[model samples]
Target: MTKAGIIYVVGTPIGNLGDFPPRAQTVLAGVDLVLAEDTRHSRKLLDHFQLHPKLQTLHEHNERELAPRLISRLQAGESMALISDAGMPLVSDPGYILLHAAREAQVPVRVVPGPSAALAALAASGLPTDRFCFEGFLPPKPGARRDRLQALAAEQRTQIYFESPRRILDTLQDLADCFGLARPASLSRELTKIHEDTLRGSVGEILARLRDDPDSCRGEMVLVLGGAPAPRDGPELAPVLLPLLAALPLSQAVAVAVQITGLPRKQVYAEALRIKED
Candidate 1:
């Protein structure tokens, strides 16, 4: 009996077809079948390299239904390759279910790494590459998206995100609001393409650049945000106490602020008195 075949998770170019590695082309050509996120898009990549492997559509909507059948083929000694529309197969795309199934069925699986937009953006952004996080696409809705950003506000490691062209402004504004305008950030768009560019600065600065050069918002984007600044040794007294002072009597505000800040009541009370006297 023939040995069970392998599944190769191949990465294609994020942009610039020249970035397609020779090994990836060979795997796509050699596989018994090639699974693609979009057959039309994948066909262009295949045609570029003169590959004519059997093609099958396997996207988010249909992956669940098709993974089992594909796994069966792998078990039956039919080698296959999975490719996304761009970048690594499963970074922000489909192929996880089928890859999982392949491993569970004891079929050999290999990776053919190529261009990845997230890593590309990060590397070029000059952010700390030692530790980072990949947050693939933020929530489309403003409320939910803001909430998500709020949760990541204190993340110490660099944050990476893939974003859509249309939502660039909204996302930048949201980041400015949650993370504060001074937080450093980098935005790279149309990566590896003709007009590819990276804008690096504080979040507010990048937002202004995007606003002025509306053209920057026209393609796929990867955002790299500097992690929140390390917490100060003591509570931030002023921003914390101002609101309470507005709504409460001086003594009451001081009492509340002291408890909340974990600062000595004497200092808070004195600060409250100064604000009142001013």
Candidate 2:
């Protein structure tokens, strides 16, 4: 039986080549094959580092078909690396199928971590990063996009999204409409490149700036939106507390009720006991 080979899910720079780690360079250079979302685009990165490796396309359209063949190659003991055009693979990018297949086959997979546009934007955005969610790209069609935004209107965690230059303005308009004009947001574009710029303001203000300066809309974009504010009034407790107390142990029920109601644990525990007594 032939020993299987390893798959390295490498991360490339989003913009500045300087952000590419040395470990990523070594892995890419040593790998027998490099699976790229775009062979043409990835070739430039390889050439910049003076490294030559076999490049193959593994993008959205062909990933499902290509994954099985690639897995066979790995089983045959050929080491491979997977990379997107920028950032990590499988982040609003392709490669999930291949990675999932590799895992099922028990092939060893490793990550050569590096820059991510979403992380870079969020870090620089000065928003609450303690608890956040990446929403990737919103729906492209107007109605679908608006519907999606409407669904996320109540999301409490800071949200990150990737947007294209062509759709930035329109997306901002919809974000303002759905999330409210005064909601805080940060728009970071052309990150890590010389012309990198991050505009932080209310959704409406950022929308106004983009309209005033069309050039800002160019290049890769990441939008970070503040979460919904906590409700001012606490919800009435009995309806929330009674069911939990009945179904769960007193302590467990109180803990869950606290999470759901955003009320003090002590208060929830007291209410739990009172309801039990009643």
Candidate 3:
């Protein structure tokens, strides 16, 4: 009787090949197969480390149909490593389905930590990292993107998102409008690469810089927005909320007025109290 092989979740560099973890090489060389978001992209890493395996492309498109095939190999005592085009796998990338199937088949699973663009950018951002959230990407439509930012307004924790070079300005504009034009932000690009740069400033300032000198940014980018740390409880809206409460019932106007500012009633109530006093 033979034991089933394990599936290793390997993390790779987003840009600089030098960031590749030494353990990633060892695991890949030991695996019988490699599941990658893009075989060609993974090839560059493989060449750099002088390690190779039977690489297979398993992205969003073919995940449903191809997962079974990979599982069959796993049952055959073949261990495999799953990697994304950049950073960690299934983080704004694919391979979740395969991972799910692997577990269902009782195959062993292990992770080899590597570089992450989200962490790389967030750290270089010089923004709040004690607590953060990864938004991935906003909707492509300008209106939708703006709506999304408005939704996340007052999130409190720093927000990190991925965006294409072409859409950087637009996304920045939306965040500026929703989070406030003067909201501090950082635009990090080619992190770990020779041209790695984390341009930091208010949203408006960064937007202006990127617009004036487009060449300053290339490749992928991570946008970090400083969020007000989540209020321990909720916001104390009593001040601003008090005035409205005096004019109308607390329950009726609490939601309506807070809608525009995107603050909780507790926060608005605290503001309401201040409004009533003055």
Candidate 4:
């Protein structure tokens, strides 16, 4: 009787092909089948390594429907490997459904770790890595994105997020508005590539840099924002909110101040308006 073959959740290189581990290559070559987030993208990786396995599409759209069948294959002593287009199989990528299904079926499951953009950026971000949170991607809509940032405003641990090149400036502006212009942050783009770069400073500084240098706005970006400062033993309102009223319109100032202070909008607005009157 044959034993069940293990399901390998593999991580691939985010950029440099040389980052692909020997173990990952062996697994991909030896597997009975390989599940890829994007077959076309993974195809190039496989071809480069010259290790072709049966490729099947298992992305966010089809992973649920295909998971059961894939799980059955694992149960039947057919080893399989799962890979994303880049980075880990399921870090802001797909393969969760099938992995969960495999676990439920009591099939052997394993992970062959490789490169991760989150960790890559965080390590070089010059922020506190001892405690940090990975916020994969913000909502694309402005209102929703700001709302999310507002919710995370007081987070003490450093925050990491994945963002598109085109949206980086807008996101940085939003970060400045929500976290305050002085909030420390880092932006790393095209990690491990020839043009890989990291910019560290206040959110406003990075925003200005990117705006002036359009060349930096052409690749995937990882954003790391410093956590809010510890609360002082006093009314945490005036020092933070009053200045915004001086710098911006009443409503706009209140909106940003509320996000930064986590205070009630009505109260901030009233105070801002009073500041304007005074």
Relative to the true structure, candidate 4 has a C-alpha RMSD (angstroms) of: 3.7
TM-scores of all models?
0.85, 0.82, 0.81, 0.88
Among all candidates shown, the one with the greatest TM-score: 4
Task: Give one digit per residue, the lDDT tens place, for model 2 in 1-278.
Answer: 11139999999999999999999999998989999989999999999999899999988999999999999989989999999999988999998999999999998998888899999999999999999999999999999998888777778899999998999999988876566677789999999999999999988799999999988889989999998766433237888877887799987787566556544444556677777887
TM-score of 1: 0.85
Indicate which candidate wins on lDDT: 2
Error of model 1, residue 82, in angstroms: 0.5
Task: For candidate 1, give the lDDT.
Answer: 0.83
Query: Candidate 4 on 1-278: residue-level lDDT in tens?
Result: 11248988889999999999999998888888999988899999999999889999998898889989888878888988889999988889888888888888998988899999999999989999999999999999999998998788778789999999878888887877666777788999999999899999888788889999999898888999887776543345677767776688777877777567644344555666665676
Cα error, candidate 2, residue 66 (Å)? 1.1
Where is model 4 more than 4 Å wrong at Cα? 1-4, 239-278
- The TM-score of candidate 3 is 0.81
RMSD of each: 6.4, 9.8, 5.6, 3.7
Worst 10-residue lDDT window for candidate 1 reads: 258-267
Better of 2 and 3 by TM-score: 2
Cα lDDT listed for each candidate: 0.83, 0.86, 0.79, 0.84
Clashes of 1: 0
For residues 191-275, what per-residue lDDT tens digits would candidate 1 score against the true structure? Answer: 9999899999988899999899888889889999887665543236677777998999887786666445534344556677666
Model 2, CA-based lDDT: 0.86
